[model samples]
Target: MFRATTATIHTLCMLALAGCQPSSDGRDHGQMQLDACVAEACTTLNLDGYGMRDYNAVAGLAHVTSLMVSYTDFADLSELAAMSQLRELHMGMTEVTDLDGLAAFPNLEVLHAQYLEPQSFAPVAGLARLRELAVGSAGLDDLSFVAQMPALHRLLVVNSVQGLDLSPLAGHPGLRALDLRASDGMDLRPLLTLPNLQEVALSRIGEDIDPTQAQVVAQLRARGVSVDLDAIVVPVC
Candidate 1:
């Protein structure tokens, strides 16, 4: 009887071991498959127009680290919420109006949304780790939201905006680079107050800028700010 009991226990152990063995087919995990699909799409995608079909094809695979959907015809990008591991997201020339889902990406660092509207950036304020942001040619009328980004380093607000006061940007101590090209009729006084500012691109000056402001720009250049006046077409008389 003792021998029989020992044999039964040994047989059960062998069965358990067999069950634990890996499958010979070597199928990948669901998440890994998703990641691969996203990586492949990001590498080969073109940003010509709305890409709802393309995005829908790979929406199920959402483990991508970097996603670029530039110049696509996508109107609603809410499906991007699945990409939790996304680090860099570039959606230039898309019609996406809402970015509320961007907050889900905790590791998001760089975001480039050029040619978009100001309202499109409202959702990115919640991204805690955001570092670099470029929203050139987005027709932004307000920059109050930038003050909320504590980790922001580089900012580009060039072209397509009017009547914007950059005083709020003074709170951003980590900001290094700023681009305000083509912003005609804007005052440069508020921009001069940034404490850690290093690089500034001022293009398309309006009648508002005067010789005094030019002197201020010279002072900023003396203090290590690389100010570019190449875009200043007509001097303020």
Candidate 2:
């Protein structure tokens, strides 16, 4: 459960936590045809499916604490800024590039995205209260931006980032769990410095360990770190 709301889950956001029909795969919504889809989904908590509708309703809920909108086309996200109480959001497979709109939700603690584009991460760089971030995508090499998140506790990346430099995670006091099996040949040395890190899972990766990495693993084990080397590893998600 989330600290912000007892109803919200830690890993699964509204779309996955609640029962809602997701948008059909391969549906392309251009500029004009997609606004209606966005409006209906955002206004009502249930995006059950995507279709053209006439209503442009806002999430008139009293708390406005959590929301999920997936498979909708949103070129401009100015509408989301009005949700001052928003604490968690799941942006599912969106074509929206204006992610800076998320900065408005200062109370936001958890974020789960079905897609991860390059500039999409920049907007949350200053959101210090962010705790959990889970995003999946094929192309993600520079995750250095994660260092900016002060309260980040869990980071689950279900995508490949070959030869990623995890050096940025050093000294992150709140980081406890890390799941990075999709990424290959990562440097584990940086993780050794994180004092609060409790669990680390790296599975299904080709054994390409060097002497330096083995030494780091040995040190971590000696320090009581939980390491899952072989398993279908994943974080809370």
Candidate 3:
């Protein structure tokens, strides 16, 4: 009978373990693609359809300008802190819950935050350079953040925010277009205070508009603003 030495057994065990482990090169296909994108300095990166949750590789992409991460499983925006050059970010249909990392991008211009219900929109309050914001179906109720954004001209809030409050939008300096489907009983007096308001498309979610709201709409139209109030149906005589 041949006696196996301890060294021989240890060597055999090591080889077996090495064989069991997956090769690092083939382990992560997404990481490899991301690495290639970073190497090429690709400005636009679309991470949709990857079903990826880990964003560690995204930190290396410093030159990415337009990033579309819809359909991803990422819950936070921390990994994108290094991407300060990002201008347009489309984050629709994602699981992202927090936007604290958005503070890093000071030059962000366009933001499409549709279909995501963030805990708070406070992080966006500091984005002074953000111009276009589309928040359709985001279930946002608070418009206080918009008051701080002086450059915001276009705001789209369709199919969200029941019993909406327009007090926050009062006295907006550059607000030109407003499109929203708000529930009935919303205060429409705030629309009169916007200095540059040029267009409005309001659709009520409930029955006939109140007399006060109708009067407000009439006043807005009287001011040369193109107002479309199809939902404001007065009771038939």
Q: List the candidates' TM-scores in order.
A: 0.70, 0.70, 0.71
C-alpha lDDT of residue 103 in model 1: 69
**Model 1 whole-model lDDT (C-alpha atoms):** 0.61
Pairs that clash in candidate 2: none
Q: Which candidate number maximizes lDDT? A: 3
Per-residue alpha-carbon lDDT of candidate 3 for residues 41-89, written as tens digits (9 for 90 to 100): 8887766435343676676677788886654566678777887888988
Q: Rank the candidates by TM-score, best first.
A: 3, 1, 2
lDDT of 1 by residue, 11-122 (tens): 6545543432323322233234335556665432222232444455545545456666655555566666666777887776667777776766788898877667645566
Off by over 4 Å in 3: 1-42, 48-53, 136-139, 159-161, 204-210, 230-237
User: RMSD per prediction, one decimal?
Assistant: 21.0, 7.7, 19.0
Error of 2 at 216 (Å): 3.2
lDDT of 2 at 145: 74
Q: Higher-TM-score candidate among 2 and 3?
A: 3
Clashing pairs in 1: 49-72, 49-73, 50-72, 50-73, 50-74, 51-73
**Backbone clashes in model 2:** 0
> Residue-wise lDDT of candidate 2 within 7-52, one digit each (tens)?
2333434544333343443233222234443554443243323422
Number of backbone-clashing residue pairs for each candidate, in the order shown: 6, 0, 0
Every candidate's lDDT = 0.61, 0.61, 0.70
